[model samples]
Target: MSSATRRPNTNCIHSGTRIDPAVGGVNTPIHMSSAYLQPNPQAPETCYPRYMNIPTQQAPADKIAALEHGEAGLVLATGLAAITIPILAMMRPGAHAVFQADLYGGTHHFILAEMERLGLAYTLVPETDPEAIAAAVRPGTTLVHLESPTNPTLKIIDLAATARAVKETNPDAVLCIDNTFATPMNQNPLDLGFDVVMHSGTKYLSGHSDLNCGAVVTSAARMKAIRETAVNIGTSLAPFDSYLLERSMKTLAVRMERHNANALAVAEYLERHPKIGAVHYPGLPSHPGHAAAARQMRGFGGMVSFELGDSPEAARAAVQRLSVIASAISLGGVESTITFPAETSHYKMTREERLAIGVTDTLARLSVGIEDVADLLEDLEGALAAL
Candidate 1:
């Protein structure tokens, strides 16, 4: 079947492959070569690793393009590399962009620290609705970047409306979304009219917490620009990791099903607990963004953020009490983890800055894993009771 018609699970394993003519291997072989045969020595990067044209790299990238329904895609060594390269490529000096206020701390910090030094300008839209995003667009805006089911807060953006917001406000501006929290199985931003979709493959895409990778998928024209920037910057995914990324993605759909189910169960339980003040989960109707999230996403995703007591100390103590869910920084692994946003992802943001976007000290993000629901619930109950 064509990639477009293939079911998601089938596409995960087969979308990027061609029948092997060499050894009939089921998987893409890692090409460790630093060199490739150059009939015209001038084009030395025709099939080089750094250029992201090697078979191992292309296979997974092609898989992402197929899964995301984008014309092209690229994988890189780290999520930051995938995200920063495209933003930098699109917004040169004097250009401006509008960013969603609640973003991955790394991305948010990059804009704050580098935009001025790089001679670019940006506006942060506090509200996630399409109207608010479009209102922030400057006259010379070259990009509008946002995340749906936003980090730490779980605020959902209307992808279709947001894409329209960018097109109507600044036809020239590119709309990019960080789809890490909403993996490809749950949402495909490109189909919603987004210009580009990027992900921290270190999270959901890797699933196992073993690999650190990233991806950017967009139209062929836009990808050419981003790929050129990546080639120069040399952040392309190495062959071995590229191989691992593809291998890992084969079970993405399977894992996400469990993630979605467990997260909703956890969110429901948390919402009922007297110790938890608020539960931020799109799967729950109580969430302010539930309607928007339901309209845009196939699944509400595995992440659930909730209030733990009223202080950072209480949040820290609660995480420490969890014997099963390890306290960790990065998330989206097979093993469950709980961490305070104030201490990890958004720690760099000042208390004032963090609170401005609803990332309070009492907020703790639970990355619900594929563990048995009963066991996970017992662990959480123990933690909350301790707290």
Candidate 2:
């Protein structure tokens, strides 16, 4: 089925499949060998590590490209690697990038450090105002980047409107979006006018915590550049990890449904709880970004962030007391995870900067899983009670 017409779930299962020629096996076999032999010296087919595109990697890349509604997709070793390599491919020395200030700490660190070494300049602005983003664009700015439902804060940037403004002001600039948190199930940034779409495939795309990978999906022209850079840098995902990501993608639709349900339930529960000073979830009516979220996202999302009336110590205690949820740095797994952004993800930021972005000592970020909603709520309730 073509991506244009196929449904999301069907794309998930069929996008990357190649039936076994001899046995008609439904699953693609893992091509573990790094190299392949050529048929002849003059007339050849698939011969080297650099030349061979294994079934395991190609199938999943095809599927993800279809699922993301992009011309092509390239896989990478990690989300940060996926993000940095492409920007490097597009940017020249002295080129500048304007980006949202609110982002995953890992990504934030990479951009800050790499740009300095590359002689690339950047401007980080609050994404809440489109005008602020426009104002940050300098004469040499060649890229505009952003994350919606931004990390820890859950603030939404109006993607379509921002894309339009960026294009209008800097027609030569490429607009890229980090679709990691939202995933393609909820939003298609390319359709909204983004030039490139990136994902930390280690998260919801893989659905499991085991594999760490990333992806860049966009138009074929852009994909060619990303793929060349990916191969040259040796950042492409390993064959086995690609296989795992493909397997996880097969259940994406169902997992997303449960994640949405559990997240909505948990957000509501936290909003009503006496100890919660503020809860930030796009699914909630009180959220400032709810309208834009409704327009763009199919489901709100699984990630939820909220603050308590207590201090950082109490927040740590709440996480330590949870019966089922684990305290960890990662998110978008089958099991729920809780983390303190001010300490874990965004620890690189100073205290003043963290607080400025609404990541306070009391703030806790939850990556809701597909577990029973009732059980999750009870676990959280018990933890908060102890706090």
Candidate 3:
């Protein structure tokens, strides 16, 4: 079915999976074999590894392609693998890339350090400003990477505007969006004119945090390039991990709904709380991009961040007192997670660097889950009291 005609729930449940009549099963069976059997008589090439025709790989890839509203998809072993493969596939020596100032720390490290080692050029710009991005673009720039509702800070970028600007001045430059925060159920950046859409399947797409997989979905031609890079680099996801991620994706619609609701409630609560210095969530009325978020996303999303009234030590104490919310780094699980970006995600950046980019020690990012809102609030209240 066309993505435009399908409901989000229908897309999530049935997008990538078609039961195999041979197996007579409702779900895609996990084809665990690294190698597949070729038909008898060395027939017209039945299947093989390191190439194409693997049901395990094809199943998830098809699903993500459909969900992201792209012509095709490629799966990788991990989110960073997904990110890196595309860079390698698309970039040449001396090519420059423009990226958001605030990105997932691992991604920043990859571009800032690893890309330099590989002799590539990059510029960091505030993704919210299209003009800044335009200014950063050099004659050799070929890619503009963005992360909307960016990690920890939840900054929003005008994807459509940025894509148009990039394509207008640099027709060959491809705009890639990290769609992990707002899953396919929420936004389709390709439809917004982005050239490619990437997902960290380790997050909301997998839902359960039980698997580590990444996806790159785009036009068929782009998919071919990504596939070549993925297999050649040995970054393709294992069948078992693909199965787990596919299973988790089936419930994406329901989980994202709860995630949005819980996040909204938490944002509102924190907004009015006496101890909270500031609350950052797209659902909040005061948020800079609340209207744009409503326009592009069906829901606000699962993540939230707030500044504490006390010092960094007090913030640490508050998180330590929380019983229901786990103090951890990754997010988008059945349970809530909280972390201090200064120590967890942005620690590698120096103090001045972190402050310059708005990641402060007092900033506590919360990944709201499918938990009871009241219980989570109570836990936060208790934590605040301790602080």
Candidate that would win on lDDT: 1
Q: What is the clash count for each candidate, in the order shown?
A: 0, 0, 1
Alpha-carbon local distance difference test for all models: 0.89, 0.84, 0.84
RMSD of each: 1.3, 1.7, 1.8
Candidate 2 backbone collisions, by pair: none
- Output the better candidate (1/3) by lDDT: 1
Looking at candidate 3, what is the lDDT of residue 213?
Answer: 86
Which regions of candidate 1 fall more than 4 Å away from where they truly are? 39-44
Best by TM-score: 1
* Candidate 3 Cα misplacement greater than 4 A, ranges: 1-4, 40-53
Tens-digit per-residue lDDT, 45-106, candidate 3: 56654553577777778778878888888777888887888888889887889888788888
Question: lDDT tens digits, residues 134-220, model 2?
Answer: 777766788987888788888998888888877777887888888888888888888888888888989999988998988888899
Off by over 4 Å in 2: 40-52
TM-score computed on alpha carbons, candidate 2: 0.96
RMSD of 2: 1.7
Q: What is candidate 1's lDDT per residue for 20-105, written digit by digit as tens?
A: 67788888888889888889878635777888888889989999899999889899999999899999888877788889888999
